[model samples]
Target: MRDFTWHVFTQTGDIEAYLLYKEMHNLGAPELGANAGAEDDEGNVADEE
Candidate 1:
């Protein structure tokens, strides 16, 4: 989705597409951040059983 939005933004210079790409990038940033750690759905580390 981000790639598509970015492609559209580049091709047409649509401000909305650029904004959408920026918004999606910002929204996904935290999930990949440091505090996320190596945890699972139950908040358990991957190697701890």
Candidate 2:
């Protein structure tokens, strides 16, 4: 049991750390892999200040 736990942790530790970092970095928006801001038909942001 102990060895199995250690093996799983060793294999997934880096992936877990990376996922945590990504969650932390992309705090405001979900990582949906697409542009998330408002846009206009002319390819400009309509809400630009």
| RMSD to the hidden true structure, all candidates | 7.3, 11.8
Ten contiguous residues minimizing lDDT sum, candidate 1: 29-38
Runs of candidate 2 exceeding 4 Å displacement: 1-13, 28-49
State the lDDT of candidate 2 residue by residue for 1-49, as single tens digits.
Answer: 2233334557787665555555655664334323433343335545453
lDDT of 2 at 25: 53
**Against the hidden reference, what TM-scores do the models get?**
0.57, 0.29
**lDDT tens readout by residue for model 1, 1-49:** 6777788999999999999989999888332433443454456645567
lDDT of 1: 0.73
Residue 12 lDDT (model 2): 83
Which number leads on TM-score?
Answer: 1
Clashes of each: 0, 0
> What is the number of residue pairs that collide in model 1?
0
lDDT of each: 0.73, 0.48
Off by over 4 Å in 1: 29-49
